[model samples]
Target: MRLNIKSSILFALLVSASAINFSASVPDEGMFPLSELHKAGLKKAGLKISEKDIYNPGQIGLVDALVRVSGCSGSFVSPNGLIITNHHCAFSAVQLASSPLHNYLQNGFVANSYEQEIEARGLTIRITDSYEDVSKDILDAIAKTDDPIERIAIINKKKAQLVKEAESKDPSIKAEVSEMFIGKTYVLFKYKTIEDVRLVYIPRQDIGEFGGETDNWVWPRHTGDFSFLRAYVSPDGKPAKYSKDNVPYQPKKHLKVNPNGVEENDFVFILGYPGKTFRHRPAQYIEYQQKFLLPYTSELNDFQNQRMLEAGKNDKATELALATRIKRNANVMKNYRGKLKGLRNIDLIADKQKEDKALANFIQSNTALKAKYGTLMSDIDKHYQLVFTDAERELWFNNLYTGIRTYQIANLINKLKIETAKKGTLAQKNEYFNKNIALVKKELDAVYESYNVDADQKIAAHMFAQAYNLKDKNVIQTIANKNFKSADAAGSYIAQNIANSKLNTKEKLYNEVLNNAATLLAYDDEILKSQQQFAHEHAPFNQELTRREGVLNKLMGDYVAVKEIYQDKSFIPDANSTLRLTFGNIKGYSPADAVYMKPFTTVKGIIEKGNSGDIDFRYPQAIEQAWLDKNFGAYTLKGTNDVPVDMLYNMDTTGGNSGSPVMNAYGELIGVNFDRAYDATINDFAWNESYSRSIGVDIRYVLWIADKIDNAQFIIKEMGI
Candidate 1:
């Protein structure tokens, strides 16, 4: 059994990141963790079932049906590990299995039998077994040191030890300790990881992504946005990697799909692993996002998207390979634009300022509070001031390392040289090479499989030009090793490096570069030499940022404590990729003075959009014909041939909530949550019921597509519909 070095490193880093955490929530603003569900007032808020039915400690319950499908949330809908999630969540797998001959991304996929299901490479699922609070242990360990860096080290070491102890009891478990609130609380979550996930059904792009970028975060959407998958385990009911001997995993519980979905004002809720939210941060943090982060990332993403488009022009294989990356970049670019708009539209910074001022006054009025929190706001402001000081320079170095493939490979080679030098004996060096050479080859193979040199060079040149525009000329001069009179000069230098470097092409990377790493390190290859220089210059700045984060963590924890006292309530912490419960009534909101968006969209909406001249709106002829023929079957809304396509609710959600099961009062699946309305994009900063509606494909629509259009009746029967 070989070690999975990549998985091990990722697990360690994630465990360490658990030290910093966020917010307090009112009932409506809360994505309440399962341990805190008792405070959510479920029955009082119209739950038809008991609380224990949703989460029963030491027993299987509705929460047992939930699973984390990669970054998104999903649920078991059948006794045999049949899982349902968003189409975009499974898009990469479909893209991987696709080709010009049988493009699954365009034509859709249906595995009529188990044998036909394609292996979903790099996609895995996790069922959370249990969680326990470990806040006291971590805080106590850190209390010995006031030095910020030392404190961070202590906390990380404590978390690692706890995870190791937990996993030692069971080899099948993957344990993680997540921060619930920065410097304040921590929880250890145990998950059963199944690596053999397969794609069972996925709709064509015309159906899954109808209206494409235009309707992505908009309301009254007609997109299906749903897909089906299956999870498999070893025959003896243990987690294992993909293999022929694996069988479908049988979960202790599964969700019951309700054909009769929700109506206006129906009670609804979601259970999912909602991603990060900054609702509790100080006003200065919001200022940082508004001023720099959002704009810079959005613009960079847009630039990359255009380069990809140009690279794939008239090349089918290139287009197929870049499909997923292009789609993901476009989605994020547009999402950030919306978030910027939403931040201004809601005046979020001004609102946060008002809250901060009120809290300040409250502290001044109480002698004890003043004593404890006198410098809290000031310290937080100071941290941001430091962040803003060198933000532009830091941004350049960060993106250079993260955004360039050649730079990454160069860094890895440099690392290998350092490690090899540490080995004092020939035998030890040989042992290292034997263990790692195969992994290096595997990584380089993947890089070449999707490599587009021309487009990437353009992107790299663009980034260099952008950095050269900074007001501080000395830093750029130091980095480039020369003074440039114009940004184009800087860009041209990097473009030349990328084009003429010895390791620019696959053959050169393997034979001249990877095979002779020591010679390249001792001598100077243009690309590797420049990358090493950048790494050397970046070391101090990165260290400073880490120290600042440690100090900020402690400051924010104090802020949380003081805010809790000021509000006189025990609040639900913000989401940090942990399982949580958020409930709200099915409703809609007005985005403008005269506009009132409806809560439900029907199949008629799909045809209306399809008739538009936009290619994104063009649907399959079969779908339009099915609508004209009134082929909605039993899935139609009562008293009409209309089938609800997508519905809106005000449930609090964020990025990782995609594919979370939307359940009715009785805890039966009613929909699959996918996106939030454009206005709700700002919810991550601050959420209010007025414009925080979430969108989901109604379950009736999911069933109708499987039964009437795709003819995947086996999925219908397996869901016990």
Candidate 2:
């Protein structure tokens, strides 16, 4: 057997991490040693962990309290079984569960009890208990099939067999035999999901998203970013739908809110589903970001923001509706700019490359194992090298322009007009067009607003002139012009035409053209109807993604096979969506020669950024004054409001991870991990732990938002001190 293929691979790597206490008694890193950490940290705190310390998180009782609200990790804080998570985590559900009169986000929502709690369709929470090491079985089954496609089929067949076996027994539990680190390993994780997870409490959008996109990533955070919800189970205690008879899901254990509050350097914890971070990326990627991507993106954001603001200043309603998209893109632009500058500093990335090469050499030492996964590691790097080049990112950005809301609307209007051609009735036509006329108006202005006509037309002309192979620019422009909202009529002109008898050919559209107020109305949004789900879902793109997965998986399996044979520590790819833990000390690094961000920030930093008029930097006046005047000695801000929060932790997380908890060994609420610094944007592909500080909006701020700020007593009480 190759050295890399040997079972000793994992043991050797642990030694390399210089992980404290190399004994078998300590739990493995994959599961995060939650129960062990609780036992160790709690006892040290003079707290005891008894059988009662055990938690039945949804259905996985074996998981300790630390898993609570982290990602399928939460304790039943209330006797009624309430779950707490970041407000953004609840956005999708809140969007789904909301109504015209009962918007969950605009005004904070609270369901008095379970029955009234809105069940947002398809939102699910699952707890896993049964995990079987099916690595050997799976690898053996797929060994002969070197072709990636065949290998995927073989692996899937094996996984299906395992799932079939599990279903025959429990029937209720969903059995998933999945690959970890790609096909290099397999784990059969059985989950008992609670489908009836309900919304219990959500803050008004003003508070939950207060400072909105401006305050999203940057900290010294006054953002009131928390929400509470619960899961309900049937009387029988198995997973069931919402019913009057069901009971509040009893969590493994609920966390103490620490209203007495967190102190600087106190052992604070955050347990929530953290999206993802790459702490093992190469330094070259970091350099590429600082040199190319950051400048391009920052320029792009500035250009877009200025154009949108200029076009929109004279038009308030036009700005109001489209500002949402502009604001979001600006946020990404800001995040990368900050992260790129922060990550480019030598301390985080220079040493990173040194470390990466060491891991590469470890693979080289084990000849037999190297033969299997050695190429896998190199190939994985190769894929990224090929796919993540500067040109590729530009290509990706160009693709995004196609999906812009303004662009989509232009196309939709033409489709609607074609649909109504032959149908004819004056009153019926008036009603139909009246419903959609606002869309046409918005579409017309939106296209013009998207870019200066000369610039827009020039880009259109340039794109058309320069391209070797091209699609319909004229069609796009045609849709942009006449079809988009009566070709520029004001609100009054539209109002008078609804009843006019002069036009009859397309009465439906004529009516809409006449009656549509310039502002958006209910029928204007497409998400209202879930049709064309296939085109919307983009079947072909998904098919390509699946094929790419096979390539990626084969790359994964080979690495594990070689690493195991070599008896080297197999570097597990950072969690794609499963659980993962990354640890680092609280420290600051040089942004350049003279610029050093002390590990934390003070309220003063907020004031500085505010006066600077950095559009991305937001500090509401009331909150800004409160922080400046308030006592924060107990909280350390080494720089002005730029303090490093607690160490970030969570299961796999990604784009949606904004405002997640960064828990510690204690499983208590600590800091909120908001955004990663930009220079390491590529870190999502790999972990370069040095540069990656899970940027957190301190818990002090969350409590501050609850108490001093919004002063929502209803919410503070629900935290259930």
Candidate 3:
């Protein structure tokens, strides 16, 4: 039937509005697996390469170039196993390799040759070899178990067996079975682990961590958060521990870096292991976070960071030791603060409830769906209510145990008691004791290195004050009442205990505590007694919470299956530290009214933000001179002649995605994904395309630092530039 001109215009408007609404609602979502990229609408999203070009189990692809760098992501930039990742990803190694004289963390390091590369002890890199769907195998193994706990045990056993068989095939291969969509699907990932990793190059802290906490998660970022590491292997090309005889391992595929750099609206994609996200979680969870969890956590994190900073002041060794931990805590605190703000700004609970209502209406319209999925949302809400009820006590117990040294000592003592109770021969018992004693001593040494009695005491006092002020009936208040009249008195008592305790020193912990396990077990201390009482009081709540979580996971798994069936929509599983591909374009965002954040920031921003008095803003003299001289060399942008420091993209990312390779349409390395904008931290809970933007260190800035500042020509040549 033909329509009138006016009717046709109205119809066209309706269709256009519908399309815009759909686009706005969905955003550029999904952290798809390599095999599912095609189905994820990659081509329609402007992917110029085939899915196979990014990942192929049977052949070398972009996946081969990716590596899991400790807890972060990295990509091979050279055939000789040179990897590029965020400097913060390698921060621990840098700190470990630093000392009063060398101070790698402050000065950075540049290896002119392979021989000069410093060994990164305890660092390992893993490359994905293969992955396969193991959902049926896991489901079958747990099919007979109706109890959630028993089902988990059965699934874990099956997973262990699978990993054992896979690893037994090759000693160098590490295997893991990761559950996706709660438990609806499972995939076994096999990786070739290279243990001999070495630090190749790192820019100074002034460049690497520029602007520090002040500019973290903010736009117009100028941080050159990039570093290089090389993977080494034995003579026969097998993974081995650090050795003098080891050589740089050759990778099957390495990314060809495009030093020419990317412009705004350029197609960008990322392949890495994202840590976690709760985009599919029920509305109750969002409500709980908004009302309670995020604010409380942020407060605790702030307290802890302040204590650490106060303790580390004027002590270089202590500062170096606490640097990594302080950075982590500060990052988390900022993230929680951002998340809380974003949650309130977006009215996430109302939006989630609206979505839930629509889903419920759809289910109610169909008989089978009504019967199968009608109670899912309510069931989730019910479980969340229980969680909220026990959260206060749980928070108290967790904070006391985590922040107090005495509580940790109590745990160690209890572990030692359990070890002594085990049945074994005298020699075997002695062997176990010696082995465990070494471990205990190592742990005690680390604790002592970072621990400050005054700081811990202050933290303990704060915790007690919080519990007392809230009139919490938890063990914290009970202990406070028994030991002292007020939180200040409680703090003083804990401080005295910390100062007098033998556990304060490693030598005392070993010779006095470890060598006399029986004596330690029989000893009575106020801190230890308080820890025991706290654990006893919280045990039931902890057990119930675990059971509730298991049940909730199963329910969520069922809900996912039902939604997929009824809605006929693609259900990408929540991230669980597994490899996934997310694609988007370099784009700016409007964070607030009339405030447009451009996708890219140049070196000019760095200079503008620089302050010689602040360590974070201070640059090396060479870098300053080069910038003044306009020595961008080949790293300059074509028309503007400016070196891009960082760029923003709309790709989905999380914690572990730091250092992830930001690639062009053809899968060439262009940047490194490091941090997301502050307003986008809520992407973990819910994604709003207008606010969710991930930032990356532009490759051109990295090269500019290498060539113009550090004069690392050999490293540049090694990339075959």
Candidate 4:
């Protein structure tokens, strides 16, 4: 029988089957905030530490040691601020410090002394110092706004004012306001930004990125994907940029390394910032992502990867420069592929549809709810359909500007025109021009460093062809119709213009355009004209998209409010790049029939997988000899002669959780979380116990390599191993 709202509403709402179950019997899921851990069933899951041991604003604890390094997570392993994180997390910094003669990326780096540590340009580490609820403040400020846009503006103004006030209280503090629980909650986080980060140690590509793309998200992996960095501060022990006078930062608390690696079903928890998730989104959104967004993104990424590969061949400089870009593109491509497959396998759309139907039925059966939320689902669905109608064109337009250099140049030109129109003194105008010109030069230099004219031309041609072939008329089609006989003709014309344009050279740009902004503004440039026209035509669609998003945000917040009031179930806020704690056991599962994956992988697997000539499988001769000789030190697991490489757990995690410290029940560091299993990629939308698993590099393997291969005994001694 269909459930009647009047008779069964409370019972049905009390038990949220879709949410993470807090019972000990269920697989551990949910990225919970540190403040919520005390009430989040941690004790039932065998936590050995108190709530204050994980986080206490008044005192230093585990959260204090956890630092936001670059865009990933890392933890201080020593009081002097020796940080341990994933090698991929430090890839860009290593690349920046590397050159043809001193290739730190190909060969590993180890600092024997503090002075040997190299400066990592443009790298920073952030530590959260305090947090407070600001929900009441924001809600009270926006209580009178009936219009969604006005409400958003008021909320933004209040948040900005709060952050500014908080930051003004102390020079060392950087403040940000975070919206949580679908905007039902607001929290202001204050961070101490340490800007002088340095590279301490990193393994060679062979060990750090051993499996490469072949085993990126696969299980039973042997990748030793961990690196060490050190944070530095000014002589007065304050945040500052990199300098020789800086000293290593002394953190109040750092994690103790536990060489005794985890065994099966052992309690494990991770504390770090998870990037983002969309688990609370409606069924229509999921359908759009699965059917349209992922497919489109996957195709574009695949094309970019191919172009980058072709451009990198036989060119060492280009190869080195494009390595990070190639890796990023390939990672996203693989992720989208996995997400697409997982969505189909899990039938998330159908499940969401069922849930939506139940929600609709309940609302319809109640007089008050029927009046308030009767049209909510239909409204959202209609807006989503309208947005999807122009999805292809919007995708093409956005990506074309980012992918092509000419479009970027055109944007700069447009910006200069705007700035020129402003009333200012002659000196002020020149100063503005000079500043903007310098920025343009920097951007152009970066573009030319990795830019391949031929590859870009091919990409532009393909993009034009796709855009022109679409049923709807877009700016690309209009441009082609106005200027050329076909898409190929237009592409060739644009490519030639990019090749011959004076903007290609920085000196020309400065002398010709910077000093003569008015003349250039009046000059005829096909690309600039097309871009301006495109922006003009695209404004209406962009505005509509923004309006729909605002409406959705308000409706979703109201839905969350209703659910919280009516349901007795606990709800953890979705991830939004904030520090969170997720606990689970060291266990494994079968991804397919007759295929059971063990919880841990060992160095023996690495030996078996190694091939002498292959880049991904090859290892150093000394490392292979040490493995063959069975030189397993105290870092080896108990009752086993082999060293553990990587392990899998059921902890909930996402993108920014990479390099997060995986600790035992005692709050001791045991491993570093890096990637998720291929089948678990869909966890961002829906986490399934049967398939979801997070992969971490065992800390023992890291020490083993540091001792045997790198002979970095100093680091080991510093960590008290």
On TM-score, the leading prediction is 1
RMSD of each: 4.8, 10.7, 7.7, 5.9
lDDT (10s digit) by residue, model 4, range 1-721: 0011121211011212342222223346688776556656777787898877887645667887889987899999998989999999999888878887888998989998999999876578998777776776787797777776677777889999999998898777898998876545677877899999999999998899998998888898999999999999999999999999999999878999998878999999999989988887778889988977889888987887788788878877767777877788788888888999999998999998987777777778878978987887777677778777877777877786667656676777777766765837666666666667667667666665556655666676677667656675334555645556676776676667667666555566667766654554555566667677777767876776666666776777766655543454556777888888898999999999999999999888887888545567887777788888998888787667889999999999999999999999999999999999999888889887889999999999999999999898888899987
Q: What is the per-residue lDDT of model 1 for residues 99-199, given as tens digits with 9 covering 90 to 100?
A: 99989989999999989988987689988876677877898898778888888888899999989998998677888999878888887877889999999
**What TM value does model 1 have?**
0.94
Least accurate 10 contiguous residues by lDDT in model 2 = 1-10
Q: What is the lDDT of residue 500 in candidate 1?
A: 83
Q: Identify the leading candidate in terms of lDDT.
A: 1
Per-residue C-alpha lDDT of model 2 across residues 358-384, encoded as one tens digit per residue: 657877787764664466556666755
TM-score of 4: 0.92
Higher-ranked by lDDT: 1 or 3: 1
Give one digit per residue, the lDDT tens place, for model 3 in 1-721.
0001211211011111231011111236777766555556777777788877886545778888889998899999898999999999998889889987899999999999889999885478988776666766787787776786677667779999999988998666898988776765677777888999999998989889998998898887999999999999999999999999999999988899888888888888999989989877778889888877788878987998899798889888878877887888789889999999999998899998887777778778889878877787777778888777757666767667667765776677767656865837656656666667767767666566656666777777777667655543334445654656676776666667767776556666666766754555555566666666777767776777667766776777766666565555545667878888888899999988989998888887777777547666877788777878888898886667678889999988988899999999888899999999999899889876778899999999998899988888777888888
Per-model TM-score versus the true fold: 0.94, 0.61, 0.91, 0.92
lDDT of 1 at 361: 91
Clashing pairs in 1: 21-182
Off by over 4 Å in 4: 1-26, 421-428, 439-450, 473-485, 504-524, 564-567, 612-614
Q: What ordering of candidates by TM-score runs from best to worst?
A: 1, 4, 3, 2
lDDT of 4 at 567: 53
Best-to-worst ranking by lDDT: 1, 4, 3, 2
